[model samples]
Target: MISIRLNGTEEQFPDGSTLAEVVQHITSATQGIAVAVDAQVIRRTEWASTALRPGAQVDVLTAVQGG
Candidate 1:
């Protein structure tokens, strides 16, 4: 198990989990989502290959349309 900071909150996941897995757990929407790890933005194509390390700072943001 490993602990990571998710959007300012501490969260846990199994060891060796990828960023894609965490993103899936956070939302079902496939578009308008942005993810950053340790303040670095990660591309969608790289999410599956990006591994989450313990005590990592992860931030997830979703875009919203408003008038």
Candidate 2:
């Protein structure tokens, strides 16, 4: 198992889980969501290739319609 900090909370995931998997596991929504690792925004195209590391900070953000 691998440990990661997701959105200020600590969570565990299977080893070799990609960013896309993490995002998919957390939320079911497909669009208007963004992910960042260690304060860097990762493009959608890179999610599949990006792998989570131990102690890495991961943040998931959802967009709101009303301002």
Candidate 3:
């Protein structure tokens, strides 16, 4: 098991889980969603290759229409 901070809350995931998998596990709506790891924004194309490390901070942000 691996520990990560998801949107400010501590969460656990299987070791070697990619960012893409994590996003899917959390939600199915992929459109307009952005991800950042350790305070760095990760490009959409890199999600599948990005691996979440223990103690890493992850932020999942979604776009809002009414701004």
Q: Candidates' lDDT values, in order?
A: 0.93, 0.91, 0.90
Count of steric clashes across candidates, in order: 0, 0, 0
lDDT of 3 by residue, 8-45 (tens): 88999999999998888777987889999998999999
Where does candidate 2 have its weakest 10-residue lDDT segment? Answer: 58-67
Whose lDDT is greatest here?
1
Clashing pairs in 3: none
Ranking by TM-score: 1, 2, 3
Candidate 2 per-residue lDDT over residues 5-63, each given as its tens digit:
99989999999999999999889986888999999999988999999998889988997
Q: Candidate 2: deviation at residue 60, Å?
A: 0.9
Q: lDDT tens string, model 1, 1-67?
A: 9999989999999999999999898889778999999999999999999999899999989867878
Better of 1 and 2 by lDDT: 1
Task: Please estimate how well model 3 matches the true structure, expressed as its whole-model Cα lDDT.
Answer: 0.90
In model 1, the runs with Cα more than 4 Å from the true position are 65-67
Error of 1 at 42 (Å): 0.2
